[model samples]
Target: MRILIVHNLLWAHYKSSVFQALQHLVDQQADLSVQVLQIARNERSRAGLETSGGETPPTYTYNYELLFDRYLEETSVRERTRLLLQRARAYRPDVINLTGYYDPAQLLLLIWAKINGIKVVMQNESTAADQQRGGWKERFKRWIFSQCDGFFCFGSQAAKYVIQLGVPPAKVLLRKNAVDNNALRAVYERALPTRIQQQQALGLKPNNFVFVGRLIEAKNLPMLLTSFAEATKRSKNGDTWGIILLGEGDEQTKLIQTIHTLGLTEHVILLPGRPWFRVPEILALSNVLVLPSRSEPWGLVVNEAMACGLPVIVSERCGCAVDLVHHGQNGFVFDPDQATQLTQQLMQFMDSAVDMEQMGKAAKQFIAPYAPEVVAQEMLNGFIKITN
Candidate 1:
């Protein structure tokens, strides 16, 4: 069986990990083959995340054909659709996997696959609760999902949204997200001994609540700062822990101003985001991960933090919070709208009321099931079921 996977970017390290694992599975099966058609090298939004050591290297080894030599954001939609159709026709895949319904070009491909009698599976990251949904877009999404033979979703919330849109439960396979756990953990463990030194070098406290993502409004950076300030003041130990924001965006300047306004200059640190491989190094220095997004689809950083054995404090709005975060167990989930609840959760960690080490262990254990190998096997199983 020949499978064609359509993805938007070759620079997506997380997707590359799954694709590599899928390739490993295919290598063991003589009858199965997989090929990916990537729209471009990277997106305009993440151009800074791309490293330039002469040229950016492939994050994972897999059989993929990049349709355009550069990133797709600058490419013409008409040309992109034409090229995508040309590749799909040339590949002649028995099954095709489209990334999501938001892309009109890929929607065209999905329609073509249906007309050609090819099995189609879709991978979705969005959740109905992530934003206000109702209108022509919702109607269009339902119609698109109807054409799919099956689905691979980001998490339970994402899966629930798809089922609500009329997809049968049996047709949905994956309901989780993961990173290169072993690979990330290996680097993190190697840097464990020097974690303190690393933190001290950055003028950070021994313990930190780290937020790693784009510094945009949706991340609720202002709320994080407010809660962190309140948590620090309320702490009996007197501002014992620090907060770190790692990533860049338009809100960086505003976030800095807010930190100053809160008189948290020494308490909060803002670092620019690094490439995927280097993120584990930063995670090693922090005691816990914090994602306070007002709206997040899956938040892959949560998975990366869990793999590194750092307990997370995720916003309840995030899809991954539904599955990965177990309140007061592996990590805590706080309502992004309520600063007081977040402050209280942060206080628990600051006071050392909870055994962080035990929670960290629980985090690692919980995240193990969401590894790339497991997800790849599930993907393969879902494909087999659909094709059979």
Candidate 2:
């Protein structure tokens, strides 16, 4: 079996990890082969996160082909589309995995694969809750879903979305999203002993929650700030738990002003976005992970945090929250619009009565099966199911 996977970017840390595992798995098989066509090095918003700060070079690498080591935005739309079509035809794959329906190029390639009697698997992360459904878009999505032979989904929410689109339950495989769990755990554990010193050095609170993602309106930064301030007001030990916002975007100016207006400058610290590899160090210093996105397909930061043994506070809208967060067991899931609910959940984590260590351990244990290697096997199983 020869599988050709088309991915958006070479610098996508999560996808790269999964591809590495898939490649490794295929290597041990008798007649199995896997190859990837990385459309670009990075997207425009992600350019900063993709660059290497090291002097020598990247020590860690993915064993695959980078079709274009430049951002897609650097090239004309026509040129990029042409490149994908040309590459897919040349590769002559027995089976192909497309990025998603949103990509016209990949969708066209998926159609081509079907026409040529090659198996096609689609990657879907979108959940019904993440967006406003109904209209021509949902109908178009249903048509696309009907065409694919198999699906690899983010979680239960995503799987359900496809089943609603007329895809049989048996045709959908839920691998969930994953990070390089071992790598994150190693980075976090290595920094664990010096967490106190590191927090002090970084001028951060000893016990704080960490929010790592783009500072956009959809991320609900303003709402998070409002909720945080409310939580502080309700807490007797208000000085103990602070928050660290680690990412940059258009909403930075607004988020900063809101933080100051809310009188949270001393309590809430905002740091410029760092690359994926550097995130685990920040996670080590923090007590919990909070992803309060108003709309999110899947929150991969939740996976990274859980892997580092940090319980997460995720929005119920997030696709990963359904499968990964166990609602007060491993973490808490709150309605993003309800400020009081968020405040209550935050207080639950901040309370000294709560055994955060046990919750973190539960988080790590819950996330073990969502590793890249495990996801790779699920993908292989899906491919086999479709091919047979």
Candidate 3:
């Protein structure tokens, strides 16, 4: 079987990890082969996440062609459609896997593949709560979904969203997304011995709740600050804990002002953004990962933290919250609207009643099933099922 996968950004390290594992699988099976067409080098918003060498990270192990070595926004739809069609025709794949349906260029390719009797699979990450949905856009999504032969969704919420848009339940081929678990754990473990020294050098507290993402409005940073302040005030041992915001964004100035207003200047620390590979260093110094996003498709940082053996506190709106978080066991999930609930959960973490080490072990165990090799195998199985 020949599979052609179309992806948007070549700089996406997480997807590259899965593709690498998929290529390893293909190498072992004489009948199976895979190729990828990367639409662009990276997205404009993610340009800062590039390696210091200003080159793609040395993580790719799969066969892929980078069609445009520029930001995604710089490429016009006509150029993308023309090149994608030309490549698809040349490759003549038995099955085509598309990243998502939002891109008009990819959607055009999907229609072409269907016309040519090639099986098509869509990898989806959006959930019902991702954004407001209704009107002609919904109808268009339904039509596009109807053309797909199979799906590989990020998690349960994503799978349900596709099914709600008129896809048959059986067509939901794979229901997981993954990161490089072994690599993340290795990095975290390597940094473990020096974690205290690193934290002291940065003037960070002994125990910290770390938030690892862009500092944008959607992340609800101001709300997180308010909740963290309240949690600290309510917990007697909260003085030993602190909150670390580890990413750069437009809200930095405002978040700093909010920290001052909340009288948490001493308890809150803001760090500059780091590359994807270096995130485990910060995770090594943190006790828990907190993602209080008002809107999140899937919080991959949660997966990274879990792989590093740290429990997470995620909001219900995040797509991974349902599948990754086990409330009161590994971590807790709360409604973003309920600031008091988040405060309570934070205080619970700092209190002596909760066994953080045990919770961390549970988190590691819970996230093991979402490893890159496992997801790649499942994706190959989905292809076999659909093409058969």
Candidate 4:
């Protein structure tokens, strides 16, 4: 069996880990092979994450080709379609896994693969709650999904969204996402002893709830700030706890102003974004991970924090929330729009009633099955199912 995965970005360190696992799995199997087609070096929005200038390079164990050694935004649809089709024809894959349904170039490639009797497995990351569904767009998505042989969704919400779009439940082959679990755990373990020193050096509180992602409006940063302040007022030991907002985006200025207005300048700390690999360093100092995005397809940072044995507080809208978070156990999931609910959850963590260490252990256990190696095996099983 020959499999070709069409992925969008080379700068995706997490996806690289999964591909590495897939390549390892294929190596042990007879007559099985896997290759990847990376569309571009990175996207314009993710240029800061590129490890081109002396940073440690990511591990690339899979056989692959880079379609364009530049940002994807610079590539035109016609050129992408031409090159993608040209490459697919040359690779002669038995099965192809496309990244998503919205890309015109990939959709054309999907049509060509179906016409040639090659199996098509689509990877879906979008959920029904993440965005507004509509007239022609949903119809177009249904038509595209109908042409797929199988689907590898990011989580239960994503799978449900596809089934709602007219795809049979049996066609949903895999329902998980992954990150470099082993690597993240190793980093966190190594940094554990130095956690106090590092937090002191950065002038951070002893206990903190860390939010890792772009500081955009969709992240509901303003609401998070308000909830944090309210939680502080409700807690008896609020002086020992703080909230860290890590990552940079267009909403930084507004968030800073809101912090000052809420009289949370001392309690709310804003840190610039770091590459995904270095995120565990920040996680070492945090007691809990918080992602309050009003609309998140799949919050991968939640996975990273869980791998580091930190409980998460995720929004109910996140695709990963349903599968990963067990409310009152590993973490709590609350409506992003409800300030009171988030505040109460935060206050619970700030108080001594909840055992965060026990919850963190539960989080690590919950995220174990979503590791790269496990997810890679599940993906391979999906391929075998459709191919046989």
TM agreement with the true structure for every prediction: 0.97, 0.96, 0.98, 0.98
Relative to the unseen true structure, what is the Cα RMSD of model 2?
1.7
List the global CA lDDT of all models.
Answer: 0.90, 0.85, 0.93, 0.92
In terms of lDDT, model 3 sits at 0.93
Model 1 lDDT per residue over 1-388, tens place: 8989999888888888999999999989899999999889898889888873454544688899988878778777787789889988998999999988888888888889999999999999999878999999899889989999999999999999999999999999889787898888887889889988888899998789999999888999999999999988889864558988999999999999999999999899988888877788889889889999989999999999999999999999999998999999988998899999999988888999899999999999999999998999999998889999
Q: Report the C-alpha lDDT of model 3 over 1-388, residue by residue, as the tens digit.
A: 9999999999899999999999999999999989999999999888878875564444768999999999999999999999999999999999999999989999999999999999999999999998998999999999999999999999999999999999999999998989898888988999999988998999999999999999999998888899999988889988999998999999999999999999998889999887788889899999999999989999999999999999899999999999999999999999999999999999988886689999999999999999999999999999999999
- Model 2: ten consecutive residues of lowest lDDT: 54-63
* Candidate 4 local lDDT, residue 353: 70
Over 4 Å off in model 4, which ranges? none
lDDT, residue 112, model 1: 93
On a 0 to 1 TM-score scale, where does candidate 4 land against the true structure?
Answer: 0.98
Give candidate 3 regions above 4 Å deviation. 53-58
Worst 10 residues of 3 by lDDT: 51-60
Clashing pairs in 1: none
The lDDT, on a scale of 0 to 1, for candidate 4 is: 0.92
Question: Model 1, poorest ten-residue lDDT window?
Answer: 50-59
lDDT of 2: 0.85
Candidate 2 residue lDDT tens string, 142-243: 998888888999889999999998999988875578889998888888988999998888888778989999988899988888988988888887778899
Candidate with the greatest lDDT versus the true structure: 3
Residue 247's lDDT in candidate 3: 95
Among residues 3 or more apart in sequence or in different chains, the pairs in candidate 4 whose N, CA or C atoms overlap within 3 Å are none
